[model samples]
Target chain A: MKIEVTSQMTGNVWKVVVAKGEQVEEDQEILILESMKMEIPVVSPDDGTIIELKVEEGDFVSEGDVIAILEED
Target chain B: MTKQVVEEQNELKQKIDKLLEKKEKYREMGGQKYIDAQHEKNKLTARERINLLLDEGSFKEMGILAHHQNLHPTMEGKFTPADGVVAGRGTIDGREVCVAAHDYTVLAGAIGKVAETKVARVREWSLKNRVPMIWLVDSAGVRVQESIGSLFAGNGRQFFDQVQMSGVVPLICALMGPGIAGTAYLPALADFVPMVKKTSYMALGGPHLVRSVVGEDVDEQTLGGSRVHTQESGVADLEVKSDEECLKVIKKYLSYFPSNNEQKPPIKEGVERAEITINERLAEIVPTNPKKIYNMYDVIKELSDDNDILAMKPKWAKNIITAFGRVGGYPVGFIANQPMHLGGALDGDAADKAARFMNICDSFNIPLVFLQDIPGFIVGSKVEKAGIIRHGAKMLHMVSEATVPKITIIIRKAYGAGYFVMNGRQFDPDYIAAWPTAEISVMGAEGASSILYHKQIRKAEDSKAAWSEYADQFRNLIDVEVAASNMLIDDVIDPRETKLQIFDAVASAWNKKVERPWKKNSIRPV
Candidate 1:
């Protein structure tokens, strides 16, 4: 199953923790966003392999923006 | 003299025999052929379903001999046993409940003139007696041939009765077969509807009517099947595989409610399988990092009695959690935020869901426990267009109007208007406590600081670094201790002590009563 990881808040992507094709566990932090001067981690909702990374470091994304796509194991 | 007496006894015997024969016919239920067909369709007869729903031998039927009064030549000989409905008062798990099951065997369970009257009568009885009403809806809509003029026009009383009984008593429905047109409204008004998979269907019109009116071709299942109602439309609360399972679900749902709103929910003896202890894990379960997400369910479970909680609408509007669980073996309703979803923001749907749950709990006199981890109500033009203002106001209205003892524990992130809606100090919750991790703020520190020091931060050589430093300083200002010092909250306590604190608060307010200014009721925002 393919899952879309969406940002819950508008923020600047501070770091991209996983690259495409990298396996990640549920609740694993896939990226950190700097919003309101706080570092907010966007975690994977399920254990999956990252099929696509939609955002890069320093990218500004709005709420509900898809940041990554994961293919569940 | 003896001969005359014997003759009178013989006459009485004959009359008694006739009455017994009539009852046998009523029990026959559309004869063996129709019953066999019902079995073939994997559906139970109406009485059989009621038998499974209620305690055995407890159903005292009301209108057993009622039949269609339509005396037209075509309908003259038609045998409408029990008027195609079996309604009565029964005990489920030894608690009184009123039930009406539409019998599919007789005229395909059509809601004829008499059947509608029978249902309406039972609804009235249930409402007056203040007992929960369980409707086993499986009707083929109004009997079109017999329902004309007065019969068709007077059919609306049933729906009216349903609306009247809305908050007065719990209404539960199980769709065991097709319920089209007029019959569809019963389940729609029900507080909980469990649809039987495959056999159960509900729609405003059947395939034939739809085809005739809209020129659309569709099958019954395709139009209003169990899957469609439960998943696509969310009209039904659950989809069970069989009639038996549907009844079981109804029984379980009723366990959470009292027989009526006037009484407390039935207590489960020795329900606390585990001793109430402060789990140290709760202290660390909430992350110190403000922006990190944590599973709120874990914290709820740790505090709930025996770690047992029944979450309602778990999939819908999941940012806020609404559930029924026991705290210290006393039934309490829980409203919490799931930071895992939407960063625990209150969106339109979340507000509606929580507000409705609060209303239910308040109406039933269930104590409410608010676990605050909300950031704020979602902001944006999209949400405004979605009517978040009115919906969010509904939540506030319910919380403020609720008469039941309310205990609030701010685990984390009580920010902006979310704080007030979640039973903050302004709402006058009976007891309000906050964990050390709670951040009582107007907004997140970063956003607030940027607005306050906009010019200064913009003028800094490294504006980003300057903004972060200012945000950190503002964040430290609104910690739980600061709020407690200002008397904005009751106290800042350890997370592990939450269970005990809430239990004590609820116990102290167990007999607390409020006297409101005499009025019909306050009109809540939609």
Candidate 2:
């Protein structure tokens, strides 16, 4: 299964820490999203590889909208 | 008929002689000076306290000089008069109220057999009159000399009266002296308790008793000082240094509410206390560096009306500040966390203090100004053991339940759940403003870079140097340019102009109408 990490709150994506198809582990943080000027982490829930990053650099995401998806090996 | 009148006059003279002889006998036994001194030291003489609180000469003393005398031969000499409590009825600044003032010097104003009856009478009067009740408690709890008999007399009637009167009419109790043991609980059930520092002490038992009961040793101040009560455990509402200040707080607090909940709020002058001016140069007051810290107190002080900030528990909750300050002469509750203390983190004590203050202000229809500059709650295994999760969540729940007008100002840092707890947009703040220097992120740049971008920097030849380079890039995410792209915060206002903007925002929300039950004096959770 892919690592589908979505935003928990709505705000601008302040920073991207990982690139597409990057290897990730369970509980590994993938990116930092800023909403209401607060940075929230988009992390991997399971050990996987990022297949597709839905939001590009500096894109805004809503609550529960996917920010990135990871493909499990 | 003239002979009959002469006979009556002779009988009166005989009675007067008997009273004079009794008075002389008491004087011989040293009762005269002791009774006279006690009568002199009463909070105010019956006439004066009544006049100051009630209409001049309006109070009708229900049971003046009501006393208890012994019918049994062994108890012949033991008689108590009003048991040192003065309870009566009169108007307080035009509003009628039932009042009870304890006479401190009289047996240290201890509750005795006759005094408990007087307390019951005034409590009953408060219930029957439907007027507000103001108690001036300056007692040393129950009389040790009277002991079990007095406790048995006072056991049930007084509490039943307080319970029946709660929320129906505002019962204001002022602890003006050494309030030990059972006497402390009077204020515990009161709608408000205004205490005088050093003079007042409220505890279930005195230090000696506490030491004996709990196997701990401490003095009275260490046990029940005003500082301990107001700041540590979150008990006392307002603490004044003297008795005069206590009376003033009582008057001011009463001004906010009606005599009873049935009436409407008194129309204020809406007097603008001079326009709070800001220097044009204040726009650049916030520095660009994320690491550079500014004194939030200076900013808050400059934004408030000149000499108008009334800080509460100031010395205790240093990091999380709370005050009742006037902006343009309109009162507002201000809550700001000072980053200088523990990096502006919310500890269990601060969270509990702020949450309690918020609930009280919101219940009274006061507007709130939450100054946000927080890193997060203090995190560690130690904090976990202190039940920080439960206490922190309690604050979050209070923020959600608050129905008052809320304005959030992001002065510097807003990270993690601290943002949500600090009147963030998720709680539907009426307006959210930020200083351009604020870095609103999940975590600080160094922490984020260390945890998330570790590999990218580790691959570089100089890992330490590469880590520093990545931190700067992460800091760039929290600049004014990024904030402008997101509409989360309403506006980035000048640091000096914050007061004027917040006043305008709150004034615009004035005349907000919300109705509830007729008797809605919120009884706090036990």
Candidate 3:
């Protein structure tokens, strides 16, 4: 199953912690969003491998915008 | 010895035998076949559930022999045991409460006309006696056979009676099986609703009704299961795995509440430590950095008595947490901000959750403890369209109106209106304290600097550097000591002593009283 990880808040991507084809556990931070003067981590919802990386460091993403795609393990 | 004396004695014995026979038959509850089927689905019978919830041998049943009076042509020669409802007064943990459990073995636990009367009578008994009411609903809605025609006009007094009983005493509704249509409203007006994972569901319309009326073929679980209500719809409070767990949770939930609004919450005695002790783990669980995230549950568990907390609506509105726990053996409701989700920003749903929890705590006389680490309400076009203002106002109104003893601990960022809604100094919190890392300000330095120093930064040759310099200066001004020195907040304390501090604050304000001019009621925000 493929799952699209989306940004929960409209903010600038402060950092990308995972790379394409990288395996990640559930709740592992995929990227950090800086909004409202706080760091909000967008995490993987399930244990999966990143099949697509859609955003890079310093990129702005709106709330509900898909930031990464994961292939379930 | 006259012959008349022997004849009278024989007649009395015969009457007693007939009464015992009737009681035995009604107690069987729709026969053994239906009872076995209920067990196959991992659900307990109505009597079994009531037994588990109340104390041993404490239940005093009130309408066990009630039979339906419905005379519709479809109901000819039909027999209903207790009118499909088992209702009466009982004691949970030795405290009085009234309960109504739907006997699903009888007519699938449909609410017949007489069953409705039985439930209404119990509800009235709860109110008149000022005792808490619990409803174990597992019905297939109203009995259509008995209520299919124009006779339905006289129905629906239970909901109206529930509205009148609201806030006067605690109401708990547990969905142990399907609660379709009329059965769903029982939980809708309840204070606490727990749903059994696989066996329980509540929907205004069942799957069959949806298929026929809307032409959408949805299953029972998909339509309104534990996950749907507890996670998505925010209708139910907690989801338990089985009927046994559901009954156990109800007992735990009631421990934090009083029998009625007029009485003080029953304080547990013989706590290993009545006095609060300084726990060093609190400092380790929270990060001092403003941007870093930590689980609020870790801090809550360390502060709560015996690490016991009943989290309400735990899965819904992940940004804000509402839970019931005891501090130094005193029951209190904790409203904390979860920094891990959405930067701990309050959204419409989060606001609604917090506000409703606050109302419950206030109504039940349970003190409230707020742990603030909020940034502010989520801003922008998206939230605006979602009516964040109305939702935010509802929280603001609730905090202002809540007369219960309120204790606040500013764990970290307490910026903007977030501080106000989280029982800040302005909301008349009984005791408001901040940690060394707390920043009480109108807004964060980064956002404020961008707007206040916009012209200065734009005019400078090095705008980026100028902006950073200005923002740093603003950040330096946002200090916890400034508020403490000015006496804006009560005190600045060490993070390690938070539990002891909160316990002291709650104990000191145990007799708090606030006076206000009487009115019908203030118009609260939606």
Flag clash pairs in model 1: A36-B446
- Those runs of model 2 whose alpha carbons end farther than 4 Å from true positions after fitting are A1-73, B1-63, B68-79, B89-99, B113-133, B144-172, B189-194, B211-217, B237-239, B256-267, B270-297, B454-463, B480-485, B513-526
> Cα lDDT for residue B259, model 1?
76
Q: Cα deviation in Å at residue B303, candidate 2?
A: 3.6
- Pick the winner on DockQ between candidates 1 and 3: 3
> Which residue window of length 10 is worst by lDDT in model 1 chain B?
B267-276
- Go through the candidates in order and give the clash count of each: 1, 5, 0
Best by TM-score: 3
Ranking by TM-score: 3, 1, 2
lDDT of 2 by residue, B180-233 (tens): 887887887776777777667788898878888998887766677675676565
Cα lDDT tens digits, model 3, B41-142, are 999999999999999999998888899887778788878989898999989988999999999999899989889889988999999999999999999999
Clash list (residue pairs), candidate 2: A2-A70, A3-A70, A37-B440, A39-B441, A39-B442
> How well does candidate 1 score on lDDT at residue A13?
96
What is the alpha-carbon lDDT for the whole of candidate 3?
Answer: 0.91
Give candidate 1 regions above 4 Å deviation. Answer: A1-73, B1-4, B36-42, B72-77, B149-151, B197-201, B205-235, B239-241, B271-274, B457-463
Per-prediction DockQ: 0.22, 0.02, 0.65
Point out the worst 10-residue segment of candidate 3 chain B by lDDT.
B269-278
How far residue B106's Cα lies from its native spot in candidate 2, in Å, is 1.6
The TM-scores, chain A only, for the candidates as listed are 0.97, 0.85, 0.98
